[model samples]
Target: MSLPLIGTLKLRGRLTLYVTLLAVAPLIISTWVGANTTRQMMQDQVHEMLRIEAEGLKDLVEASLVERETSVRSWAEDSLVREALLTGSYEQSDAVLSRLQLRYTTFTGLVLFTESGRAVSASTPALRDSFLGQDEAVRNAPWFKAAQEGHFTSATLTQEDPVFGMQVLHLAAPVMESRGGRRLGVLLAAYDWGQVGEVVKAALERARSRKNESFALEVRTASGTLLFDSRGQDAWHVPNAVAAEAINGPEIADVGDGWRFVALSDPEEVYATVNKLRAGTLVGVLAVVVLAALAAFLLARGITLPIARLNRVVRRIVQEGDLTQKLEVRSKDEVGELAESFIQMVDNLRETTESLQRGTRVLTETVAELTRAAEQQESNITRQAAALQQTQVTAQEIKQTSMVAAERAGAVLQVASRAEELGRGGALALTESMSGIQTLRDQVDEMADQIGRLNERAQRIGGITQTVKGLADRSNMLALNAAIEAVRSGEHGKGFAIVAKEIRTLANQSIQSTAQVGDLLEDITQAILKTVELSEQGQVRMEAGLAQARTSGDSMRALSTIVQDNMNAVRQIANAVSQQNAGIAEIFNAMTDLSTMMHDTMVGLQASQRVTEALREVATQMQQVARSYRV
Candidate 1:
């Protein structure tokens, strides 16, 4: 799911996020660790400081108690107080106690208690009358009891005195003689709680002055009773008004006798410094992150901008169908190299396209030439077919004429036979027969002349057919050239190549047809030569028959022989004419074969024409396709 979401983000957004992560990850971790370490150091320092302050306050309390006890002991051993106490003179002791109390202002009042629990002397008249130590109770009193052990001592704590109406501490010392060491009495000195409170406040003030303003202090008894608090608020809990708070138990030092000096320092003092450090570190980290992000943004832009440009160039090429577009190279980096490569590719494409267009033009021109040639060949074939048709009709006419001439020759022979039988009977009959023979000779001469002219026309047609064959060969060469050009055009030339192939096939067929026509023409020429020879022979026979008829007018026997010779020449003429007719029949068959070949040639020409037209259409289409692209 996260993968898809990340994929959908834009490159810049993702890059920026990644850059920020890369830049800030270490910063965040280091900041967290540093804050922890700093807080710990501050806490350690606070604990150490609190511990030192509490120990100092404890020492101060001990020193105050020791000073008071020493003063009381000195006063108890005074010579005047000792003698007075030994003699049980309260008045004399009162004078000494009054003077001693005057010298030590911390002493609230001084009293003398004997071993029997009697108040022997008192500095304060009210304490003398209201003394709780009346008899056995005085012996059991803590101060008197401690003094009775024959040692110097003092009360460990200051407490409230109901008779004095004040808080006071009592100090007791024994009064005894030096030599005999006889016990005299107990001397008790009272120190006010206000004096102890003042000493504790002064000691704590000194500690407070050593720390910053947020530092606070508290003193408590061993039983967790609050003795003094710097903030005048709960020593165990923070006040609502304070920005920073303290926890209970703090750091404590024992003053002595179950008394405690509890010190508390507000956390704001440490947190203030820590907070400043944290703020500075955050600013530094943010600066680094901002700089890193800017660098990443610039870097991302540098890379992606060029890629976008290249993409646009490619799109333009595709949309416009132009291959000549080139990319600009501004740097010697990978993107620059890519642009260079793209330019090279487009150049190559342009060159290939130009080559193809050139080949197409060549092929189109070649096909056009082939088309023109095919059309000309078609025209020639049509003309040749028409001529052959005419020739066929002329041959039929000549055959009929030859048959008529043969019948006339036979009639002339019958006339010559009658002339031979009537050779002694008359000149007039012979002259008439000779005239008919002369006319027969003239008709044969005319037929021979017509045959000679027909042979000449046939020879002319053969020459024309040779020219057509030459044109067919030329057209075949053109088709082959077209095919070669089509091959050079690659895929675009496939259609053209097919058309060229068809044209070449038709050209081949035409060549074959032309060859067949040439062969037929050769046969017709031979037949015409044979017919000319037969005509020459029949012409000679006609002249001989004409001479024989003229001779019959002069001599009967000579005429009869000449008539028989003429008859034989006429028979020979008839035989030659029959052979000539048979040659003409062969010539007619050759002409028919020639006509069929011409028809096929005509069909082939028509096919070539159609193929050429199709090729032209293909070239047109190719040009249209090529035009869609720029060079």
Candidate 2:
């Protein structure tokens, strides 16, 4: 029922099932439809035939009733029957009625009644004796009353005399006079109801003989009272029976007083041919299903067999890892094309595998060469790293030596600076000494001029001393006169005389000291002359010393200039050495870095060699894999 479960079935089985269903489904449906249609048609036909038989039985019963009625009416119109009624005699009418009952066996009995309702004649002795004196009973009868009223009448179903004990129908007609057509007496006939049963039985017998089908017949009155049944009591009550009816009034008039005739037949017997057809259709459907299954199985095998073979070849190629396998093409259908394409693919794969084998060999050789080259490069890089390390160490020593030389040059520069400062100080001192010597020379020249002026002033002072000596002599003369005057005055002149004597003594001492001063002035003049000569000589020497001191200052300044130049040169040498030391340090650091880089390069080369060796191993593995294939 599930599609997955159906898919797991073999192709032939699935195809067979589908084809069988396709073939048999319509056959079964048509068989069922045809069987039901046939059954309905057969049932209708059986009912139609029964209806025809019922109609025929109805006609027979009508004819019998009409014949009985005609006979009774004719007998009522007979001249002998009118004479017997007119004369009130019985012999002749009795013989006529007797002959009539003998002529028609359907009639059970015949009787005649007079105008006053007296039974006069009868067809048999029992019929005559039973109704001969029953004038009131006869006159009160419905059929007898209707005959007296000049109408022919038939009575409802009733039983005959106890001697016969059978169902019958009553018919009556009025006797009329010849000239006036006056109603005289009544003639009544008891027709046997067994005649209707005989008609139905005969019809049933004919149907059974012709068609060999079982049938039943029933006769009933207008109110459905059962009169006759050919199937006997309660035997015609079949539930599935096909039945048809013929009523009395529509086909035949006044037969059995508006009775019904019916015919029945069984349905199972009616549809027998249709049942056989259904059985035969089922057999045919089964045969068609079997044939369809066989054809589908053959078709499925034709389609799947070639595909199965292709699958087997694919599996073998995969398991064996053989690209050299080929396929055989047998047909020009799509399956054959698939096989051809598979063969082409296999050939292409074989070629590709062979190409891979050759490529792996070349790759292996290349990897081996690369590995050898990497190893040699690694060794070379190792030696280069050592050389770089040694160069870095030498550069470091050079940097240290340059630093020491720069420090020494700085010391020399500082010493030269100190010496330059000393020389400058010496030059300044010499310049100051030269200025002092020049100042001394100027003062010496001034001193010599002052000495010459002093000598001239001393000569003027000698002339003054001669004049003072003359004044002293004059004063001594004056003093002697004053002494003489005093001696002439006696008392006043004594004091005056003492004063003159003292004055005279003082003048004499003045004269003596003046002479000594003259001699000293001459000596001072001579000494002034000598001092001027020395001052002139000293000025000359001082000028010479100032010139010499100026020369020494110039020499000292020149020496200071030379020392300052030397110190500048020393400073430049120290700076150059300091810069050189820095440059050497930089070179040392660069060499150290170069050495480290070379070491790293060597390590990289060794790693590359290992990678190359790994690549060679991979190539060898590839060669092994390629060799496994046959191609």
| Top model number, TM-score | 2
Measured with C-alpha atoms, the lDDT of residue 342 in candidate 2 is 90
How much is the lDDT of residue 177 in candidate 2? 93
Off by over 4 Å in 2: 1-11, 25-45, 114-118, 132-155, 158-163, 177-182, 200-202, 211-213, 233-236, 249-252, 256-258, 301-631
Whole-model lDDT, candidate 2? 0.80
TM-score of each predicted structure versus truth: 0.44, 0.46
Q: Score each candidate by Cα lDDT.
A: 0.74, 0.80
Query: Clashing pairs in model 2?
Result: none
Query: Model 2: how large is the Cα RMSD against the reference?
Result: 39.2
- In model 1, which regions exceed 4 Å deviation? 1-10, 25-48, 132-144, 149-159, 176-184, 200-236, 239-259, 280-284, 287-291, 309-331, 338-631
| TM-score between candidate 1 and the true structure | 0.44
**Per-residue C-alpha lDDT of model 1 across residues 200-314, encoded as one tens digit per residue:** 5664566457656555555455666654556544333655222222222323321245556655655666467788988999898889889888888887788778878888888
- The window of 10 residues in a row where model 2 has the poorest summed lDDT is 155-164
